[model samples]
Target: MTVMRFDNVSKVFYTADSETVAVDDLSFEVHKGEFVAIIGPSGCGKTTILSLVCGLMSPTEGKITLSGDKKVGYMLQRDQLFEWRTIQSNIRLGLEVQHVDSKVNRDYADDLLKRYGLWEFRNRYPRQLSGGMRQRVALIRTLATDPDLLLLDEPFSALDFQTRLDVCDDVYDIIKKENKTALLVTHDISEAISMADRIIVLTKRPAHVLTVHETHLGDIDTPLKRRESPSFAKQFEVLHRYLNGGNAV
Candidate 1:
């Protein structure tokens, strides 16, 4: 089922003398439980796309709709967890706000922490945990809300290379195991190639949909394994061309 649909959506920012068109007639559909990644050149309006879907901003033209309830959770590159809050409290804050607070959801979050080897640090403040663990906690906080769609905006860019790999694997495991749909925006062609079931290639500023491709790494599903697949280089090469606006097929 198509849970989220964007129909020729366009966004233009108006100023005193000029206007900036961020997204130009972009359209796409996200299937339920699928991981769709959007990759484009820097400042190509990828993050703008997420804002439109989440209702943080409305399109200047066209339409977007969520077939079901439009509950979205956003995870930015920075963990954004409050320094004063413990991991447990951070995870539960969303639930409390949504009024879904209960023993069941609390237990579920606790189980996730324990299962992911974070239980020992549950009472620690965000500053006390390692970068990878903090990002995990940030994701857990996002997930605790049980959002209908998860929007990840380059959620690993700040980590060192080694930590990024470990966090990427951890996040992939969490999202797939939860059976949730994810839409990730990233500039790393390799990262998109590794993590996405489908990849959307976007054009430069005032971005429009140049091309969309269904990508796969055969039956081996781990992000790291996908990166190692022989097809990975080929896919990156193709994506490079698309991103360059050269026959974005």
Candidate 2:
């Protein structure tokens, strides 16, 4: 099923007539339970595309439709958890706000914490957890509401290289295990290649779809494995050229 779509979308920005065109005539569709990554140079309006999907910003022109008005969950570069709240409390905050707190929901939250190895630290503050664990908590917090789709904006960009890969594995495991569709926006081609079933490359500012590459990573299905794959290097160079505004080499 088509879970999300952008039909000839455009986003225009006017700051005292600055009039920047963020996205120009972009059209695409994301199917259910697929991982679609959008990669482009800085100022290519990748985040703007995500904003339109989440209803944070409306498209200046064209139509965007969600399959059923499903709730969207966004995970940013930072974990963004409160330092004051205990892990359990942090997870429960959404339920509290929605007035849906109940024995079942709280138990579900506890199950996720325990399954993800945060159970022992459930009473600890956010500062007590490592960066990866904290990110996991942030993801669980987003999952608490059970959104139909997730928009991740360079969610691992803030971490060190090793930590980022390990966290990528962690998040990949979680999201796949739960069978959630994810739309990831990042500037890193390797990260995109490793995480996504398909990749959508955009142009410079006033962006349009440069290309969309569908990948089949074989038995070596991992960020690291994909990077190590023989095709990985060639694909990266192809994307590198695309972002540079040349024909795919």
Candidate 3:
């Protein structure tokens, strides 16, 4: 099933003296329970697409549709946790914002923390957690609201290489465990290839869909495992060439 669709969607920006075309006739579909990654050249308006989907912005032309009344959760490069708030409270923040801080929802939030090995740090502040743990807390916070689709915007860019790898596995595991559909925007080709079931590559701005690659890393249980696949190098090379104006396939 298609959870989201962008049909001939175009987004234009206007200033007093200038007009910019960010996305041009972009069209794509995200299926239910699928993990998708979007990769493109630098400043190719990848983040803008996420903004449009989450209702932070509107498209200039065409339609953006979601399956039914799907709720969205967005995770950015930074964890953006409140240093002063305890970890448990931070996880509860989304529910509080939506004014759905009912007992059931609160219990669900607590359950996530407990199941994810974070119950012990429930009383600790964001400052007390390591970078990776903080990112996990951020993921738990996003999941607390029980979104239908999750949008990740270069979420692991802030971490060191080792920490990023660890966090990627954690985030992927949590998302899959919850049976959530996810769309991730990353400049890292390797990261996209490793985590995504399908990858959407975009052209330079005004951005449009270039090609979609289905990663065939069969039975790879984790992102790290996919990275270690023999096909990983080939996939990386293909995506690298595509991003650099070379034809794929």
Q: Pick the candidate with the highest TM-score.
A: 3
TM per model? 0.96, 0.95, 0.99
Off by over 4 Å in 1: none
Model 1, range 78-130, lDDT digits (tens) per residue?
98898998899998988888898999999988987888788899888998888
For model 3, the stretches where C-alpha displacement exceeds 4 angstroms are none
| Residue-level lDDT tens digits of model 2 in 95-161 | 8877879989899888888888889999999988888888989999888877899999999998889
Q: Which stretches of candidate 2 lie over 4 Å from their true place?
A: none
Worst 10 residues of 1 by lDDT: 213-222
As for lDDT, the candidate ahead, 2 or 3, is 3
Error of 3 at 189 (Å): 0.5
**What does candidate 3's lDDT look like per residue over 141-230, in tens digits?**
999999999999999999999999999999999998999999999999999998999999999999999999999763798999999898
**lDDT values for all models:** 0.89, 0.88, 0.95
RMSD of each: 1.4, 1.4, 0.8
| Total clashes for model 3 | 0
Q: How many clashing residue pairs are found in candidate 2?
A: 0
Residue 129, candidate 3: C-alpha displacement in angstroms: 0.6
Query: Ranking by TM-score, best first?
Result: 3, 1, 2
Better of 2 and 3 by TM-score: 3
